[model samples]
Target: MSATTGAVLLYDGDCGFCTKSVAWLDQRNLLGFPARPWQSVPDHELPASPEALMTEVVLTRPGRRPLGGADAIAACVRESPSRLRFAGRLLALPGLRGLARAVYRLVARNRYRLPGSTAACRIERPG
Candidate 1:
């Protein structure tokens, strides 16, 4: 770990499940990357609306490119230990990418239904 420029994780602040997930990542020290609530990221800093962020997990790799949904998760894993990185690479295979994307979609779409999310978790766009 040579202090690589960490990725930025933009997530929904009001979703308890999302918060818990961020906490879990933090606990694992996987959140070396900046973790910003979707609402907090300045409009100019974000390439899209907050509503777009709410629809997916956006991981910005500063000066490079951003990853979203399953790709974001994979990128996070790749930035971790060697074993996890290998796993992430394995998932990038054609067939596996589809499966991973499908899984990510399922979790993302129903995140509000998971334990911890309340009606207050509705997505809000930044002006």
Candidate 2:
């Protein structure tokens, strides 16, 4: 995540996949997007319940409404520098946006099984 001001990206700190993903993006310096774990963010900083945040990554800008998951990523990429800006454009293309959302959901749902993730990353199904 970006360390500079402007937009913020919030992720699950306890999840290995989430943390690693954040770190990966952080190192890339994606247009100064401030990334932090929701666990450390103040309640007043969030637009919704922590549980809701836990379910998906969130992107928030000062005046705009908070966006979640793939939409959040798309918004962030759109604001990123030229090199990575193409990703945001791709997300906006017709038909691709829905595909991106579907892919994001699939990966999010199965993140626990991915490498680097631990049991803590597993989201249990509701009984």
Candidate 3:
């Protein structure tokens, strides 16, 4: 289907870790962004280049700017009904965004090497 109007949590289906993580979160149904593999997203409706797709988890909605990586996750938490909303706000704090991005990069970069990941899950870093 085309990218319809809804909060979609774009993930990498090829990544075992990513798939398992999304599955675990989907089971909980604790947030607004529902996870879907990037493979299902139409290329014309993507938020960024295809390369960036595998490098970050992205949150997208019709007629709105997409949020990526840690920010996307923080947005989900902020929109949640749980106490994690506090942490989500903190992630948007001045000094924390950089830290959060760094941590997200760490995980994204290592995801392929992590347990449950296959070689195809490795994202090629763009220059």
Candidate 4:
């Protein structure tokens, strides 16, 4: 696939939890797309503002709107090996989509407390 059509996963490099998660995906070869730390990605390649990016993972592909949070996770799964595609579809289903997003938000908000996470994983909440 062309670079524009290929999916790219952008995540927070400074967060230990985030780094570990990406490493897990890489170890399993479960991510079909290239993953990059948001800090290392040039501004022009980013689909959203830096502040927004810090709040959640983002999946970007040209000619389409960027997918954030749980949606990005679903998209990554769908792009993974055939065996895991079903789970990805399930996550994106209308009925489960909202729940998945909520869970993702919850986990994101408390990432600093999760295993492998460090103080840098603490996200600043907006007022």
Candidate 5:
């Protein structure tokens, strides 16, 4: 994909689960998409609140639109020509979309309780 088509994955830098997820994505070599931690995204540049970011995974597609939570994951899948991409498409279908979104929300809300999360993801307040 051209650099302009590249997607930016904004994740929680402090969460072990998030880190592991990023590592997994990296290993797949799924088009080698670049990822940036939410903490790394300059505060002045983000359109949404830091709290919003802490609550969802954000994916920004240059020259395109941004995706969050389940949509973001689907975007990642759609970017690659793999079985997962097909699965993502299936999940986007009407019947499955609700379930998929629900599951993503549940996991996102309880990420800290999951195996790799060290603590609940939180956004730092400006002093």
Candidate 6:
């Protein structure tokens, strides 16, 4: 879909944990934007580079540069229902942003070890 329609969250389709995470959010109706696997989105439609997509989740919105990693998560939280908007704001705080990014990176690097994650969750970092 075009960015004009709304935001889209792109994640690694090959990763089991990532897939499950998206599905989990969908089940709760917390995802304000459509969630698509980066693999399925056409290259021309992708807002971020292939290496970036493989490393972290990305969010694209109309007339805005894509947000990746913790920033993307904060944006998603802001877009969710009103009841949860505060958490989004909290995540965006300068103090928490760095912590969030660090945590995101740590989890992303070892997602395969998390519960419900599978062998497919293992990913190689781009040099």
The per-model lDDT (C-alpha) reads 0.72, 0.80, 0.80, 0.85, 0.71, 0.85
The parts of candidate 6 lying over 4 Å away from their true place are 2-5
Model 1 regions more than 4 Å off: 1-6, 122-127
Q: Give TM-scores for every candidate, taking all chains together and pairing residue i with residue i.
A: 0.79, 0.88, 0.85, 0.91, 0.79, 0.89
Enumerate residue pairs that collide in model 3. none
Error of 4 at 45 (Å): 2.1
Candidate 2: where are CA atoms >4 Å away? 1-6
Prediction-by-prediction clash tally: 0, 2, 0, 0, 0, 0
All-Cα superposition RMSD per candidate: 4.6, 2.9, 2.1, 2.2, 4.2, 1.8
Question: What's model 4's overall lDDT?
Answer: 0.85
Tell me how candidate 6 scores on lDDT. 0.85
lDDT of 2 by residue, 1-127 (tens): 3312357888888899988887877678553467788887777767668888777898877778888998888777777764887888799787999999999999899999988797778887788
Model 5 pairs whose backbones collide: none
Tens-place lDDT per residue, model 3, 63-116, is 788999989887877777775577888999979989999998898899988787
Roughly what TM-score does model 3 have, to 2 decimal places? 0.85
Better of 4 and 5 by lDDT: 4
lDDT of 1 by residue, 1-127 (tens): 1112445778777788888888887667554366767777667777457678778878887577777888877677667644446767777889999999999888777776888787655544367
Q: Candidate 5 — what's its lDDT?
A: 0.71
Which pairs of residues collide in model 4?
none
Across 1-127, the per-residue lDDT of candidate 4 in tens digits comes to 3224567888998999998998897777667678888888777767888888888999888788989999998888888885767777899999899999999999999999999998889988879
Cα lDDT of candidate 1 equals 0.72
User: Can you give the lDDT of residue 87 in candidate 6?
Assistant: 80
